[model samples]
Target chain A: MGLPKKGPTLLKKKKMEDDEEEIADLSPEVSDSEPESEPELESESELEDEDLKLAEPSKNAIYNTDGIIDKLGDISFPDNVGWIHRLSVDIDQEQEVDVNDDLARELAFYNQALEGTRKAFEKLQAMGLPFLRPSDYYAEMVKTDSHMEKVKGRLLAEKRRIEEAEERKKTREAKKLAKEVQAQKAKERAKQKKEGIESVKKWRKQRQQSGFAKDDDGGKEMDFSFEDGKAFERSGKKRPGVMPGDRSGGKMRQGGGKGKSQKKREFRNSKFGFGGRKGLKKQSTAEATNDFRDFKKGNVSGNKKRKR
Target chain B: MGKKRKHSETVASAPAKKDAPERPQRTILGWKDKNNTNNNEAQVTESTVGFKNKEKDNKVESKESKGATLNELVELKSCSSCLFFECRKQKDLYLWMAKCPNGPSVKFLVNAVHTMEELKLTGNHLQGSRPILTFSSNFDKNAHWKLLKEMITQIFGVPKEHRKSKPYHDHVFVFSIVDDHIWFRNYQISVPHNESIKIARGGLENSTLIEVGPRFCLNPIKIFGGSFGGPTLYENPFYISPNQIRAIEKKKKAGKYAKKVKAKTRRKVHELSNPLEPDEFADMWKE
Candidate 1:
């Protein structure tokens, strides 16, 4: 190609072509070949710009770290498998310390702190807090370890309280069950006592019904003694203590003997020639009156038959 | 003793005639004392005697006052003016009897009457028993078409222009003599199964005596004024087929012969088949 000699325009066109070539060669390796002093100068200005941006956010964010941590601790980890895996990945990426031993140790510490924080956060959430971000969480964690310690303490206290309540409930149920068993035993004892009384009365009645007079007297005596014996048995006392004739002047006195004056008095009361003879006088008088009426009627009828 | 007391109390409360002379007094009293103490037994005896007496009276009166039987009355009244009066006894009660000089007497019952006067017009006698008048091939052949047309026009009150343009033809006309009363099976020309249109038209053209097949026939005793226990006007099963009759007869004979051959083959095949046991066949067929 031949060069046209219009100097200023030609020089302008030549500079444009050279600038295009410089732009085309703007790769990182090519940039490295440039003077070290120039890059250092450019990087200083870029760093200044980045620092200015960082400082503005850090000033505002650093102050809100406690609040953010409190809020983040409130975020619940879902029990689902997918959510747990996602949470693990998220924590791993954010922490950025990747040596196995170091990661494991950090994970343990973080989990402990996270658990404490989560409990505190849940408490706070239950008290009604708003939405929080992950960055806010880490900032709060960095700001204070005391918050996590407080949460741990509260959890321990709650666990003890729940155990105590459960123990109390169990004891109360045991006592109520024992009372019911005792009442049932008492009812069974009462029923057995009633059955004993019925059998005694039946034995006494059968003894009196047959036509043996001497046997009847003996049976009444036996029945009185038997009833006393049963009463003693039911009371769990010795049988000899309940003898019917043990007391004097009682219905059946012991030894079959009476003092002279007592005998005379007994004789006067026995006018019908039987023991307790006075008790039958009224019954005998009624029978005598009935016999007299029948005799009078027979006499009149016999007189009329003689006349006929 | 308790039962005897109850019996005595019941007898004392019951109405009784002690001195009635119809029976031996001692025996009657003994019988009454034994059984009729209860009111229920007395009432049952009285009712039974009354019922028997009433039944005897009815029988005697029925014998004394003999009148025409219901069937006879129906026959007499229907046969009075009918052209087919000679066949009146064979016809069912209350059926309109039409006679053709050359053919069998056709008895059709009219269950209801629909007239031009009732419809408030003139020029028709749609006053037939059936809502839709089903004509036998004979009636369709012998009936005065002009008279039928006039009857339809007068009864239906169809306008002159509509009647003139839409003339009555071979197709059966089903009328709703009472509003929405008439029900017809395959009434339209577009019915897929009706082969009768061609048969009906042929009958109309031929002027020969035509008999309605059983499928086209209605119960004359049911539709017309027939008494209970009277004869039923049964439709003839045999229809006149004109040129097709011989063909139909041939087809029927062929069908009978085919059925006989099929039965014979079935019997021979059954006999020829092996009477092998089930278990033996099972092992023989197993892979």
Candidate 2:
């Protein structure tokens, strides 16, 4: 056992000297470029985070091609070793992947694995080997039962979280749709009211042309209530007992007080104290000040500038 | 019953031994600091969990005063290949893979380690089933990459018909080189199967892969021509030591206040050299 080991070590020692000489020849060429490379690496240091690499390959780095090939020859298994024994498959990567991009890098790795496995499975199938475990085959697993349980629980939680997010998104969309529908219904109602008014106007014109009734006819007067299209609007004239800002349509005045004295008091209150702010009534509004019909021209100091 | 079980066990193992290729025994030895027991132990155990039958782990103390060096100890054990994990500074885990009794060994700085105990990776397979190794084509692009690939294949691949290995192949090992680092991932191949030994029809199309845990990326630092100590064959010119990186970061931070002070003085000097002239209407608004 010792003798076999000694023989290889002796041969390797002899090869090392020749490899060193080749490195020596390469060292001078490497040294000339070494100073130029250091500054370049310094500039790249800030660009890289956890895993730092030089901007470019250093020219002086040792590469013993023959020695490495010899070592490979020495260490690799003999040619008779079958593919089944190795079970290694090499897959081609189509493009260069940027290391900083986590998603693309991981995708490349995943694709490599997937493609390799496909090729490997085909080879296994051709050889008639047992690739898949039977359904009933029970054995020890790499992870424990307790561990698998945890993994299952985590997967279920992730699925539930995603489902909840989807539900929230769906409800938000539904609310938006409902609001749009409500707005559409209100617009339809407005259109219907406009159409009803237009049709009534048309009918009234037709009736007048056909000589349905005279203007003084009491039975036809009820149909004339909305003839002007101002049937729902309050009249502009002020009533004797009603306040200016009464929202109750003067019903309060009609409902209150039955005696003559109470009616007088109510009328007095309506004129002076019942409703409306006195301060605003005393101030001159824009319309009131602009009304020249209320001014007496003779009483005005017309020649004050000339007199001074 | 015990005697009958033992006889059957031997009978089951006998044919497997005959069918397996002649391979030298592989050993896993690690010397870890006392403070790093938990992480290193979990790493070693999880690594052995895949090929537990073929691998025997020995916990050597960090003290190296013993008569035999690592290579000598491995040679004495008659192991052809050895994986030695050396933990330094209670944090950095350096993995040394050496072919014993001769030359050619690789030292890698292991980073981004996640053990099998993590719950996120849900895949599981038979404990001792042989795993199919798959390598990215870029591994053959360089001489060093090629050598490392062979080393990884030999060390990680379970010998066919290993006594402790199960007959079925239910998992795959992915070794892909990205950014000059070897990334390792183990995935369980779950194919819908029938009662027969073969997969169901269209099972391959429907098959999916789930990741098992114990993921690590290896950055090769040096390749020695000898087992443990030898003339260096290849050196990565782009490789920067972690210590140097840390020191550079510290220097950058230390320059912050000094840089501010220097800038302030320079600005003051610039103002004095280019003093402004008084305006003619400076007192025009004064009474």
Give the number of the best model, judged by lDDT. 2
lDDT of 1 by residue, B152-190 (tens): 222222211121112221111322111111211111111
TM-scores of chain B alone in all candidate structures, in the order given: 0.18, 0.80
- Candidate 2 differs from the real structure by a C-alpha RMSD in angstroms, to one decimal, of 16.2
lDDT of 1 by residue, A137-168 (tens): 22211112453355446556767998999999
Native contact recovery (fnat) for each candidate is: 0.00, 0.58
**Candidate 2 local lDDT, A1-308, one digit each (tens):** 10001011121133333333333343455545656756654333323323455545657888887888889888898776788777788888888766455567656766676777778788887887777787778988887898889978977887899999999999999999999999999997677668667767877787788687665565464354355665445666777777878878687766654678787887899777876788988899999989999677775487788867
| Alpha-carbon lDDT, every model | 0.28, 0.67
lDDT of 2 by residue, B6-117 (tens): 1111111335345355543343333333334547435554554335443343455446632137766665555667776666666677777887778688888776676777
Model 1 ranges off by over 4 Å: A1-148, A211-308, B1-287
